[model samples]
Target chain A: MIEVFFQYDFLRYSLFTGVLIGILAPLTGVFIVVRRLSLLADALSHITLTGIAFSLLLGRYINFFAVLNPVYMGMIFAATGSLLIERLRHTYRFYRELAIPIILSSGIGIGVVFISLADGFTTDLFSYLFGSIAAISSTDFTVVLVLTTVVVAIFGLFYKELFFLSFDEEQAVISGIPRRSLHFLFILITAVVIGISMQIVGILLVSALMTLPVAAAMRLAASFKQMFFYSVVIGEVSVLAGIFAAFHLDVAPGGMIVVVNVLILLIVLAATSEKILNRKGG
Target chain B: MKNSAAPYVLEVKNVSFSYGKQMVLEDINMQVREGSFLGLVGPNGSGKSTFMKLLLGLLKADKGNIELFGSPVQSFRDWSRIGFVSQKANSFNSGFPATVFEVVAMGLYGKIGLFRFLKKEHKKKIKEAIAQVGMEQYMHKNIGRLSGGQQQRVFIARALVSEPELLILDEPTVGVDADSVRNFYDMLKELNDKKNITLILVTHDIGAMSEYVTDVACLNKCLHFHGDKNDFEVNREEMMTAMYGHKVNVIEHNHSHDHHDHSHDHDDLDGVRS
Candidate 1:
């Protein structure tokens, strides 16, 4: 197993993918939390899963777009999913949250139908579902690398505008911040992050990677910058540990990674609640 | 509806706006000069905010041309000369991760413009604006940690950060305690009187606005009555009747946090748009 880790180029790709996702997830997560759209991430992620299943079925059954990559198809589908959800919410003139359940059910229903029709999957399905440390291509590595770089750069450059829009959108619009353009940009960025996340975390649990560390970070940090800092620090730690454990245990890296993140969240909540109670008691 | 001859900083001449078929504002003609404080006063849903929106280009007037500075979109593309604070000032994601410095820095985003970031001079302006609002001590503090009045100062600093000639505030004092509201008005008056920065504060707090404003404009579906606050001292009944559409007994709620929840005309901004 150790030899496999060192010997395979795929293993190297997997390691790089893990590290990239580790940092990127929580960076975007802070924005989601700040904007109060944490659950929206979960809904979009499930939409990605449905897209992947649909693409795989199309490639296998219909033989249409036979040469196209299923992962790429999934990315496009998920982005469209996010966009459609946004559009429907606007058209309905109600809370955007109303679209969440409808989209979520559609994703799950389509995923179930595809899973049943595909004659079931094996460890290869595990590769797509829970992630594989042994199935990455150089191409996949490059994709993940580009995604990480672009996400980081976009967030850094637009930090002020996004902050302004998130905190006081009316103020941003009133001060002539080109808020409608920024609003579209923000949703597009979220779709991009979710699109890229499907490569490693997969649709099954991408939002966990995106949301868990931020939830933990929110425990102690009062300010947005501090919350972002703590979320990234915690995310990096979880990914490193998840990768290490996956390396030793011979289990699926994706499930292990999310489980590790959940454990960290629980621990953070426990620790925070105690401190809050103590502060009150004192 | 465009009053081209009037050399006012803002003009909404005979304008009207509506959502679907329901008219929100009707035949609203108003103007403000560059260096004068303009108080926007009305009951809730009386089209005060809608009028502000027409001027800010947030919502377009259905029937008239709204002008700002020289033109609407022209100055909209360049709003460094204007500052604004909405009623829901700091009620955003309270658990957000930014400090006070970052929040104030966003005021200069228009000055910074698209495809660029804040420069050294921008940072200096942010610091100076914070100090001017007496929030220099809280510059490094998280925006959520401050009290309501302090948060308001940060917002005002954000407005002042860009050194705008015109500053417009919408219902900035509701949901706040008495002393904080007083402090907010004091700061606003000081800005107008001392710095010569023009202000347009929209609120139901009539007495405070009447005391501080150089000019007053009451909005219902139309421009009711506008002149100096002394117009209120002389013609209060007429203005109130025009605003309410009937004779309203001007009693205890005259100078208080009168939350007019039954108002159906204006849109609610309680939720953060994300």
Candidate 2:
């Protein structure tokens, strides 16, 4: 595996991008899960898919559009979708979750139209949906690195405020944290993460990367800080193992990574359930 | 200045609030003197919660001036001087992953400022706040693992960790048991009397709070009464009528035995809102 990675630049790019996505996803996922916006990730990723499809459609006509990376367009659409979600949530305050399904459906509806307009699934669309280990280039790796750095920097700068907001939003507001802008910034960050992660995890499986590791970590974590640490560890391990397995098996890394995460979640649940059963029996 | 009389810690004047079309609070006016334990009692939907939110600047009043420490609430930027224990303090997500110490330390976040790390002094303050709430033994435990009452106490510790001059609690003992409620009031009393922290405790049970508070205010869409407990006791009949918007007969029981009776009265009065 080490020899293969050194021999092929694409393999190196895939491994590097996978590791970055692993840390970035769960790091942002902790806040997403705690804030109960886990489904918003799903919504945003689907919107990102629409953006990718639109970019692909444009690529077929205009040479200038073809030169532009689809990831940039995906990010723009994801951010716009995130802002729209926030706006709709505020508009229908009584039914906040209504925003999720509306955006998700719109994304899928628009995505299908674009796909059909482009005359069926191209290799690009398939790779965006399931992620292709072979398609990862050095440019994709750099893009992933930049996105990861931005996410980490934002988390570092706003750690306390973010923690307070996620734990209790009302309290955070009462404490005089600027609620609207911070919330919008959070949504924007979530959008960028889903957008950049499409090359490795793909749009469909992106939310799985964001949530599954945190789900497993929640069972054992004693504190928010510990939850974050455990989630990152779980995420990194799953990504590394999945990428290695995919390399050997010649499969898509996105599906394999999510499978590893599911396995980890099952193992944690099984272990915790036995302890709970024993305690009850005793 | 000195001759003009001391400034109040909080003053709400001509406050009127509405949710969409239905009015929640109308012409509400109240004041809290410095270092006084003011108990705000009212039935559910009587706008006690809404009033608290307005005072905390969480909600803007449609018409009114809320002055905190002599500054208009709109200009009151010194939030660290005020601590708020929200109505859902005990009802927060049970799966929220945080230790007692971490929750308590959150209170100091506002005071610690942005882009700054918590120092040893902040840690010491958190420990002291937890100790003050008598939750030192459980400081390391996950907050969710504790009982509802314990969680409430941790939230109180979180509020106190900021060492605010004014502490406001909005129906803080809602889900707590009778004994825990009694102890909770006792802790608030201690914070008021010993630490000289001004307290505004909003609860449904006027009787439970009547024994500990220095002042009492009854509310039902308006401030029916706001005065010293002695005056409140003198005009209890008139106050009760005004508070409920209907005549309510009362028998004055001895002060020492009011706790048990108050808890019983609250249960029967569960749905009694004007």
Candidate 3:
């Protein structure tokens, strides 16, 4: 495990990607969980699957869009998927769940079609799914870096507005927080986050990477600010530790990361939490 | 200043509002002095909450004008002078980790604005407001840990911390026990007397709130009547019945029930507005 750190540049890139994904996923996930948009994350990630498949198929055919590598192509497609989810969700107020199914099922259907069109299993697609640090290239690394910086900046600028909207939207609007602009900006930020997370966590469990830390953090933190702080810390730990363990075992880092987070959650729940607290609940 | 010396802090002139196509408030007009406790009473759907919203600029009226602190229609930019506490506003999850100070500090979001953080004076004011609400002991406690009444007190403290000229309360007594309602009113009366803050309280607790309020305003969809408590108490039934388009003999009941269950949606009050 220790030798893996310096032996391969892939390991270095993977660790770097894992750390960034760990921070960005849960930061955005805190917004998702608090706003009751957890399902939206899943819906968006499934759409990324379709993007990955398209990138692969196009790489074989037209090749230019894929010239940038499959991951960037997939990211661009997933961002579009994120935007579509927001539009559909907004249009269908009462039946917002309709948007989820449309994006999710269509994404899966596209995945199947593209995989068949490519004929042979691409090494990149498998790595993209279960996650492989071996595939992280300089170009893909650059995109991930830019995406992280943008996501972090957006989150910081719109932090208060987003918090208010999640907690008390009407109050936020009444206070002249420029809610409509903030809402769109928030969705745009989510797309960027989902795009960056695609490499490490894959199209499959990217949403899980976003949500599990927040879910775990909610048990311990007392305020929105504290929740964000702890959720990020928890996410970083799980990803770094899980990726290190996966390196030693030659297993899928995505599954390891999710499992580590779940295990950490259980330990935290056991250590600090009292189920009986609800009895004296306010 | 004499009895008439104080300037009008809030003036609602012939305001009317409709939800979709249904009219809620029709031709409502009222004036509040700089320092006064005004009680709003109606069976339900008396447009009391609607009026408060109109006053707070939360909702726009179909017709009429609202003036705050002698401002012309366009002059009242942000209503920092007006503090508000609505029933739905208390729906924050109890498990929320914010301490009473952090929760109360949110009220200053408008006053403090972005870029600049809260200053020392703001902290002092927050402490003073928390002290005023008698929750200083629980200042560090997570807001979710507090009881319903205490939670409401925290909200009141939040509003008070802003040093609003006109403090608006919309059914703040909801979910609170009967014992707490009196204490809440007493606390309010003290704030009104001590701080000299103008209070406009919309409530169903006519008996208790009425005792503390200097004046009363009754509504159903439009203004029914509003005047000094002495005038209201003297004429009670006759005055209220006459003001409503339909005759109503409201029976005062103990308003100590599951106030936490208070819905923001105004229930349909059958009585007609004057």
Candidate 4:
């Protein structure tokens, strides 16, 4: 397996990209889960799919777009969709969660229109939807690396502020944590993470990578810091194992990674339940 | 020990606020002096929350001027100087994955500013704040595992961690048990008397409020009364009846009285009917 990775540039690129996504996804996902915005990741990923479909459609007609990477287009749409969701949330302050479904539906609606306009699904579209080891180009690896660096740096700088904000937003605002700008930056980062993660985990399963490990970690970890650390560890293990299994079994790395995440979650739940039962018995 | 430059920790002059077509607070002029504990009492929808929001700059006053530490509320950038513990603090999500130390450490985030990490001194301050609230035993404990009263104490510790000159608490004792409520007020009184930290507490517990607070203010969409605790006590029944828009009973209890007997009475203003 080690020699196989060394021999094939494509496999090495997928491995590198997978490792970066593994770290970035769950790192952002911890905040998302705590804030009760797990579904927001799903909404943003669907919007990214719209961007990918639009780019693919444009590529069919325009020579310039033919060589353009769809990930950039996807990022732009996801970021815009995030801002739109924020705007809608403010517009309907009482029913803030409604913004997710509205944006999510619009994303899928527009995405389908673009997909149909591009003359149905192709092998390229399938890879983008479900992710493929062969689909991760050298350029894709470089983009993921840069995104991972930026996301990690942002988290490092604003870790405390973000934690306070996530724990109790009203208090964070009173303490003058620049609530508006910080929240805007947070949602924008979430959108971008979802946008980039699609290349490794695919659009449908992108949110799984972001949320599943965090869910599992939440059960086992006592503190937010512990939850954060555990989430990243679980994410890395799942991604690395998924990539290796995908190489041997010839399946979508996204499916394998998500399955591993679910498996871990089930194991944690079973172990914690037994502990609860033992405590009750005692 | 008072800062002569800013004698008043908080000043609200003719501050009026309203939502769409409905007034929440009107012409509310109040001043909180340095080292004084002021209890703000009002009914459920009497604009206590709105007034706190205005003071904290969460909501802009529709009509008047508000100041914090002698600076205009709008332009006030030194937020760490004023600590706030909201009503929502008592009702936080129990599933939130943070230890008491981590939650209290958040108080220093604003003071420490961006792109910086918590140092040894900050950690020392966090532990001291936790100790101040007598939550030292639960420093590493998950906050959700604690009882309601314990959680409330941890929140106070979170607010105190910044060592603010003025601490504002909005209904900090809600959901706290009767005995713990008394102890909670004692801790707050200690913070005010020992540390000389100016305090503003919003509560329905008029009985407890009168016992601990140096000053009192009554509000019901308007500033009904703001004076010394003695004056509030003298006019307690009349003022509360007028403010609540119904007959209100004032069952005064001494500091050494058994709290369990009258705990339900002091929990809510409406609980003591007739």
Candidate 1 vs candidate 4: which has greater TM-score? 4
Candidate order (DockQ): 1, 4, 2, 3
Task: At residue B191, give the lDDT of candidate 1.
Answer: 89
Tell me the lDDT of model 3 at B9: 88
Over B82-179, each residue of candidate 4 has an lDDT whose tens digit, in order, gives: 88897778667887889999999999998999889999999999999999999999999989888989999898888889989999998887777789
Name the top DockQ candidate. 1
**Once superposed on the true structure, which residue ranges of model 1 sit more than 4 Å away at CA?**
A1-4, A58-69, A274-282, B1-7, B73-75, B245-256, B260-274
DockQ score, prediction 3: 0.28
The interface root-mean-square deviations, each candidate in sequence, come to 3.4, 7.3, 6.8, 8.4
**Isolated chain A: TM-score per model?**
0.88, 0.95, 0.93, 0.96
- Candidate 3 residue pairs that clash: A222-B97, A222-B98, A223-B97, B174-B259, B175-B258, B175-B259, B175-B260
Residue B167, candidate 2: Cα error in Å is 0.6
Give the alpha-carbon lDDT of every model.
0.75, 0.84, 0.77, 0.85
Ranking by lDDT: 4, 2, 3, 1
| Chain B, per-candidate TM-score | 0.87, 0.87, 0.88, 0.89
Report the candidate with higher TM-score, 1 versus 2: 2
Give the i-RMS of model 3 in Å: 6.8
Collision pairs in model 2: none
